[model samples]
Target: MNILVTGATGFVGRRVCARLQKSQSYNLSSAVRQSGSNPPGSEVVIHEVDGQTSWQCALKNQQVVIHTAARAHIMNDEVADPLAEYRRVNVDGTLNLARQAAEAGVRRLIYISSVKVNGEQTPAGCPFTAEDAAAPADPYGVSKLESEMQLRQLAKDTGMEVVIIRPSLVYGPGAKGNFATMVRLVAKGLPLPLGSIRNRRSLLALDNLVDLIVTCISHPNAANQTFLAADGEDLSTTELLRGVANAMGIPSRLIPVPAGLLQFGATLLGQKALARRLLGSLQVDIEHTRKCLNWTPPLTVEQGLRHCFEIRQD
Candidate 1:
């Protein structure tokens, strides 16, 4: 099979490319922006992703396209209109690639979406499922939802297959953002104030996500389906920190601060959003994905964190 993967240089895309390359069963090509470097052992096609970007060259002779590129979530975006900017790159750019892939006789397109499409957070003990109506909470999530809608329509109009996977809080080696920050804090044995946070959040390991992407590429029942993926485990903020500390062979020094006081302090400091992420529940139900695809995460949360610590040590 011939496959083209966009954002091949990104954290997730790099792993996807490496796994596919090692399998040695398919011909791989990478579709990257003009500024990105090509991964070894794959063909590279360069194009800007915007309202006017052309994907004809990149989509040629490709059987599957796994799209992972986008304007990722920014804590404080300085753009005049963040939503419009996100739409231009994420929504418009993705649809353009899908249309060109269809025209080039591509078989399937796999989109990497965010669990934020369901909502910012779920009620305690109530997980978000794939069947729930989309309730994107931010500009980034809204853009992904719009792109998914458009892709389904495009798949129907053309005879192309589309598979959507929404993953929550992906973490592992080479991870960025909050995960990276936590890893650093744990490595240094810094004190944390999240010991009282009882909220549970679902997370996806990089290996698990890559495994699911590979499965969706060829699974017969994956076409026209949307799935939520996780490690089949949920952890509270304090528990997650302890896990990280254990992985790093360090003692956890967590102070039990009340969740409400923490939130209030964060609000005063303009970090309420970050506080919610730490103290709120955002769980996902992957029962449908497991039953439909007959799949399970290859690695457990502890094992994944161990691997992450090993990589950090190296």
Candidate 2:
């Protein structure tokens, strides 16, 4: 099949392209803003993903589009209108591509979305499901939700298949954001106050997420369906820290500070958002995805963490 993968330069996108290249079943091409970033000989320069960016040359004769491009989450963005910026790139750009893909006779478009579309947190024993009402808390999440809605409507009108996969925090070697920071701290053997944080969070291994995207590429059940991706096991803050430390073959120097005190300090220091992410209970239920697609994460949480560190040591 002829396939076009967007955002081929990103972390997840890069991995997807590599995995697809290994398969003889696909004639792989990648969309990028720059040259020499994708696989050698399959790069299509589609400048920026926006409402006006043209995808005609790239979409010609392509059967599937795995869109992984988006304006990713920003920690402390100082922009005047963050929501507008996010919408312009995430929502507008995504819909633009989908419309053009449908016009070009693209059969399927698998969009890589975020679990943030389900909201910020879930109570204990309660996880966000694909069927839950969208409750995006931030501009990025809102834009993703908007893109998903637009894609669903476009699918309904154009007779195209749209598969949306919402994944929780994704981490592996070279991961950024909170997971990276935690890894650095654990490597240094610094004492962490997250030992007492009892909140569970869902996480997706980079490889597992890539595997899911590949599976959905031709899975009949994935068409016009929304799936959540995760490692199936939820880990608490303490469990996560220890897991990393153990994987790194080091002692975990975690302090038993109460979660409340940690949050209070973070609030006073204008890091409330950071604290919530470190101590929040964000979980996702991928049961529907498993039942519908007959799939399972290829790695357990511990195995995933071990692989994450093993690559770093390499």
Candidate 3:
């Protein structure tokens, strides 16, 4: 099988490439941003395709196009209109790539979208499902939702298979995000004030997310499917922190700070956004993904955490 992967240099893209190489079944073509080298194996091909220009040339005879490229979340983006920046990359760029993939006769296009497309955050007792109406609260989430719409629309005319996978906070080896910062803090023996909070959130282990991607790549039932991916385990902040502490070979050092006080302090420190993210729930329901793919995560949360810590040490 020939696979063209955009964002092949990204964290998830690298892991996806590694997994595909290990399988020894698919030919991997990396759509890179620059004229650079591909992964070590000769099975990998690197081509520059920034979603503009003649990007479709790289997708020749590709069986599947896994798109992981997007303008990810950034803390320091000071554009007068953040939506424009997000649309340029997340929406316009997506449609551009999809059009090119369609023109190139790619069989499938798997879009790695964020769970935020369901909403900026899920509420307590209500994990967002694939059936839920999109109500993205942030510019990034809104852009992703728009892109998904565009993909659906494009599929109607192109006769292409479009699969959308919305993953929650992903963590594991080489994971860098809010979760990574939490792990690093725990590793450093810093006491976290998250223990007091009892917000349940969904997390997708890197391995499990990769498994879902592979499943959707060729699954007959996955065509034009919108799925949510996770580890099938919903964990609270306290449980997550304890797992991190255990993985780091240290005693749990989490303090149960009062939620109100934490919010007050966050507001005073000009970090209300951080406070909301930490204290709020962002769970996703992956029942549809599991039922459709007939898949289950092989790694437990503890196992995933161990892998994360081990990778951080190396």
* Best-matching candidate per TM-score: 2
* Segments in model 1 whose C-alpha atoms lie over 4 Å from true places: none
Worst 10 residues of 2 by lDDT: 32-41
Cα lDDT of candidate 2 equals 0.93
Greater lDDT among 2 and 3 belongs to 2
Using lDDT as the measure, which candidate wins? 2
Using lDDT as the measure, name the better of candidate 1 and candidate 3: 1
Cand. 3 TM to true fold: 0.93
Q: Across residues 1-314, which tens digit of lDDT does each residue of candidate 3 receive?
A: 99988787787887887788777689888777665556523333333333454664677889899998788876667999998889888898889888988988899999999988988676787999999999988899998999999999999988999999998888977777688788778878877787788888888888888888988899999999999988888888888888888888999888889888998999999998898788878888888888888878877788888887787788
In model 1, the number of clashes is 0
- Candidate 3 or 1, higher TM-score: 1
Which scores higher on TM-score, 2 or 3? 2
**What is the TM-score (0 to 1) of candidate 2?**
0.97
Question: In model 3, which runs have C-alpha deviations exceeding 4 angstroms?
Answer: 40-51
Could you tell me how far off, in angstroms, the CA of residue 195 lies in candidate 1 after the best superposition?
1.4
RMSD of each: 1.3, 1.1, 2.0
- lDDT: worst 10-residue window of model 3: 40-49
